[model samples]
Target: MAALISTTDTEAQSSGDPSSKRGGWITFPFLMATLLGLSITSFGWVMNLIVFLIEEYNIKNIAAAQISNIVNGCFSMLPVVTAILADSFFGNIPVISASAFISFLGIFLLTLITSFDYLRPKPCETGSILCQSPSKLQLGILYAALALVTTGTAGTRVTLASAGANQYEKPKDKGSFFNWYFLTVNTGAIISATAIVYTQDNASWKLGFGICAAANLISFFVFISGKRYYKHDKPMKSPFTSLVRVVVAATVKRKAVISSKEEDYHHNELIEEAMPSKSFRFLNRAALKVEGDLKLSGDDSFNNIWRLCSVQEVEDFKAVLRLIPLWLAIMLVSTPIVVQASMMILQGLVTDRGLGPHFKVPAGSLQVITIISACIVIIINNWLVYPMYQKLTNKPLTPLQKVGIGQVFTILSMAISAVVESKRLKTVGNEHPMSVLWLFPPLVIVGIGEAFQLPANTELFYGEFPESLRNTATSLTSVVIGISFYLSTALIDVIQRTTAWLPDDINHGRVDNVYWVLVIGGVLNLGYFLVCCWLYKYRNLKNDDQEQDP
Candidate 1:
């Protein structure tokens, strides 16, 4: 009875509880969302910590970077599976619940293994006749732990986070929902990146895992707790049954077209408003077909163009298919963001910072730098960028524009990191210690880029994709990111081997060359982004299959 408050375990029942109205203090819905956001953010820190510990065992930096890919790759691939089920079979709530449970198990196991400190350097005696260690089993446990969290993360955070946000009332409360949603998420990031980073380094691994687990469990409870506040956001019926039938009936025009024009009046207005791009023309023509001669009221107009698209017409499919290229573009941009989890960590360790006891720079500390950067960026966006954008352009930045801007920052940040890396290299043998402060500047730049990019990207991806396909779109973005991480691993290997870039002594544990890898990556990404900007220009609002462009 307690858990049954929501229709399904995942969705909060939409019953008009007294708690539904937003007033004085934080509403239950927003509070729950905040907690969930924090949980997921902390989980990210947990994953980072786990990978770092595994890396610590090996003397080789490149191997550690490659090992980090295991989580990224699996999350990217596995989510597609969960998202498909979520969109088609299970629905978002159940997928979220199931993911949490999976994550719970993964973290518990990881905590148990870490409690034993299995990965810590094993005691070795001088010629003590081959000391045997039982750490391999623990290592396997560690990987499995990561997989569970990643799998849960894919569903709960990746697939359902925005979906969770969307279940609220829209058009009116939309901005508020996003406000709390984005703010809560960044809040979580700020905490996890700082507290989690600090605790993991200063405290034992168990403490770190336990903190994360506690946070995650709190998130699980909060989501379930507010079962009374959330509106039920069920998936549309399966394509095999209801959706397919709806498509067929519409295509055959047998179900009666009715006065759907009024229902779609907003769409027409949008078409009229679009720029004269090919996509706009395409949208206009297709819309014109749908609305053959706006003169004929309803049924007559429909019958006139009734046969235009059969149930499986090529053009209909193509209209739906057009969404793919844009989706791919958004997904590709997300790659660098997700890949940063491991890559940034490696960069922090190796970069030579001039200030030390001056600052006490630690190897795994660079991961925190991004967090600091993210906070700075997050602040500027909410306080400065979004407002300035409104004033400067008169028209607010579109989601696409926001993403484009972020890409530009991503290019610049990468370039700066590369330059810093090059600078650090020049000082390698010199008396100057690479001041950790130098890392801060590049990190802040990347953070600003992330601020500009991620939230807007998230909104655009989910909003632009048809409601039924949101989960799949989210998963696809993740997949693009996963591929990027794998590429990061490959780049690390190549850089480590081919070049005499890293100092040999610090080479294994230190990612001295990691910055170089980021430098090259930034150059390539910048070039790719330029091409995207050019191609993206031709797309018009009318041509888009969905998205009621402003």
Candidate 2:
């Protein structure tokens, strides 16, 4: 039944009947509302997660931090798998709609847990030496809720971004979509960081989580409401399958004689013919037209499926192989940022968060600095930075260059964090708490760096990747983020055991030294990134040539 509906949609879309509605900006409102609602709900819970775990669940601070890191890691990483599923099986609309509903259920369950005493452990009394751990039933419920939420958010977040971009056909329009996409995302994040977080901190957790549940439920409904307007991409068999076939075919044909002639490679009359590039020439054998590789037209036999592939298939695999080094380099650039984000929350917890006599800022709300700075910086880069650079240098900054520049900013952010942390340590025993405002500079710097790199990274992947794998390409950003979150957790654990930098009570620990360590790591990663960037030859030289042509 599901396959029938998918086929109907795909056929309707492919036939190009004038009556067939595909895509337009009319879908923007629904997508934006859905994004906003999900962001508000998810970020509301996630940003304040450590506080919730520590206060409501009676978990220790360090334990709560670790749990939050793990949850975040899952949230970030699961998108890659989900994106693949969306592109391969369900398509974006169904996955996103399903994800929204699942997320709603998760948030609703959390709301119940907050409201019911039996769903949680007994609250620990202040100054108590002994604390009761949650029972298996309670832990099970909590983990189940988290798993659902993470799965839900992971599916929708990056997938929605890709879906939104698919609405437009032109590169400029797609580029514009990303600018607004990131902006909308940051706006949602800012609202969650400030308003939702404040409510969670100052009001009841029940109220905050209840709002999240309501918003998520509404988001799902809103997305469904726009079903008629959305342009749906048909799910295809996984492109990774074809990539594997290419590798297998290449390996099988390794001892065969090489052919330089264009006709030697298989080409369906439908697809334009081109010989495979010399780079990774061994893989070109996969496309070589061995005897009996091409069956007669209309033959239904599956024998040729593994032994032969199109030249484009071989080339696409080669593109991915070339991307590996650049991908690893970007991962290095991301790891420290994740570490800083996790630790910055810890810093905020210990520092004075009061703005004035009347109110106090929530520790999680402090991250609004990063979100806002990123939002602002993205605008500036798109409007001012790129144009000015093009005018001055007679060339626009490439994504790789933007990423390299962002690394410098990251290193700078780490340096500033180390310095500020050192000062905070010096004043640790003072009567007044160190002002939370001091944390803003480093956060802003990191945010600026992200503004440059994150969008550029997305653009690079989406632009360079084979048409079939664009969804997976977009999710590569999430992959790095997810890996970095886990790495951050591991780094913290190692620091805690091997050194005294990450004690539960951070005031006594040399947290400054940890930032310094990150600085050193960032510096090394930057060097590695430069090497990768220098070595990488852009696969899409047509765009580069066109830019240089004028």
Candidate 3:
């Protein structure tokens, strides 16, 4: 998604009018408003979905968690596909508009499902022997609603982020926009996780989903209203084809000796003076000039794309390759968090949720703590921590350093979760259960980690990739998150099948052991991330003050 914005800016600059009236801070308010509405709508339904499945659809606790993970996986993964559509066929406006409408329809359907009794299974107590599973027809309708919601939400998430950032030309302003972007998002999540989830738990699911539907509909209109203020970019030919050509050209010329002379390599007008970097020298063959590689017309264009590529194209592909290790490490760091999100709900259900005699905390609302924590952390980082660090060190925190801090917090969160779960297991049979507050420490830590990692990752990827490939770079984080959620689902399934540690009833299972495993994995992932950071060379350094290593 970040890539889409960069592509738009690059196109604007190439057109010799970088200061066009189509984009600037003037568009900021509208984009932020649209994002806020969408955020409220998205989180309103998603945060409580596990509970919805368990209570309305009569799903098993573990099955509901797995379903929740799969849904989240889709939420993260679909952005990549939609981003391509925005970049290749439809521009961001059409894609975002259509997606928001689709999201409204999905949420509206969910509202209908909650209103009608026949649309879901008969209500039953959690873990009851007489609880009935949803019939095939009911399940089908439910799944259809979920599918629409997932697709619609996925399309809008990253697209909106990209669109918002596209309004600003300067990198510093872009960075500030991201900070506020996430703050707005987390603020909306806080509303949904508290107000919306509370409505569902205490008032009526129909009304709660109705609110979500209205928010989505309103957000669609809000986005449409701002259409005139946006800096719209025309859809470009898919950049991926050129990347593939580079790989193909390199393979075809594998036996060709790599050239040191700049004249022997093909260079586009934009980079005529640029020579191939010494690293990955074999890939330089892709740009090496050979007899018959050029067309007889004497134009710069190659006769065969599979046999020859420009130097820029080769380097673009190499940039992607270099990012792979860090990408995997970050993905691994996120997987445990995915696991924790689902598992926390299960833990909350068994714990004492009574805030007072008048009110009880909803299990789903436990996630709000993490959201609030992340929001607070973001505020502190922006106002105090970052300024203080720069004052003392004479440099702002680099994205890689922020990511490393996130990894450390991730490990800490997992260890804390393990300790909390172990203590909770011991008090399982007590007349008074453990307070739900016990879950707060780990959840808050997870939020803090998110505050550091997610934005830093976006900044890192957006800054490092080639301008031609920038459209794909930001979407890489979404891909990582999507894969992480799927991997979390797989891990849970594997645990359930092979070990007694995760039985149907969590009260009798060893969830602490699961957290311990995640803790170990988090440590290993941190080490791997550090190594990647050390080895990586920044291709698009924003400033000399930024450090090269984490």
**CA lDDT of 319 in candidate 2?**
85
After superposition, the stretches of candidate 3 with alpha carbons farther than 4 Å from their true spots are: 1-29, 125-127, 168-176, 297-303, 542-550
Better of 2 and 3 by lDDT: 3
Model 1 misplacement above 4 A: 1-47, 54-56, 76-80, 117-135, 159-163, 238-344, 350-365, 382-394, 429-432, 474-476, 496-528, 537-550
Rate residue 466 of model 3 by lDDT: 80
Model 1 lDDT tens row, 1-550: 6345334433322444534332222334545553554454444444466345543453344465576675667766677777667767677667777787777777777677667655445544566534344367656776777777777776665545555555655555655665665556656665666566566766766787777777777767766665454444556654333234334434554333333232331232222232212332222222223444234665653333322322223222333445556555555555555545555555556555335344444445565566667667777787887899779866566766776777777767666666765666566666655666776776777777777776676666566554445556555656666776676666556766876554333423334345445546555665665454445432224444323321
Q: Could you give candidate 2's per-residue lDDT for residues 1-550 as a string of tens digits?
A: 6456456656777787544445668788899899999999889899999888878887877778889989998998899998888888999999999999999989999999999999998888789857788998999999999999888988898889888888877889877887677767777788889888888889888899898999899889999987866788778899799899999989888877879999888775777868889999899999987876645657564448688888988988988988888888888778888778777888988898888898887988877888888878988997998999989987778888888888899989999999999999888889987899999999999999999999889878977788878878888888888887788888888988899788778888888898899889888887877777766777675555323211
Count: clashes, candidate 2: 0
> What C-alpha lDDT do the candidate models reach, one value each?
0.56, 0.85, 0.87
Q: How many backbone clashes does candidate 1 have?
A: 11
Give the least accurate 10-residue stretch of model 3, judged by summed lDDT. 294-303
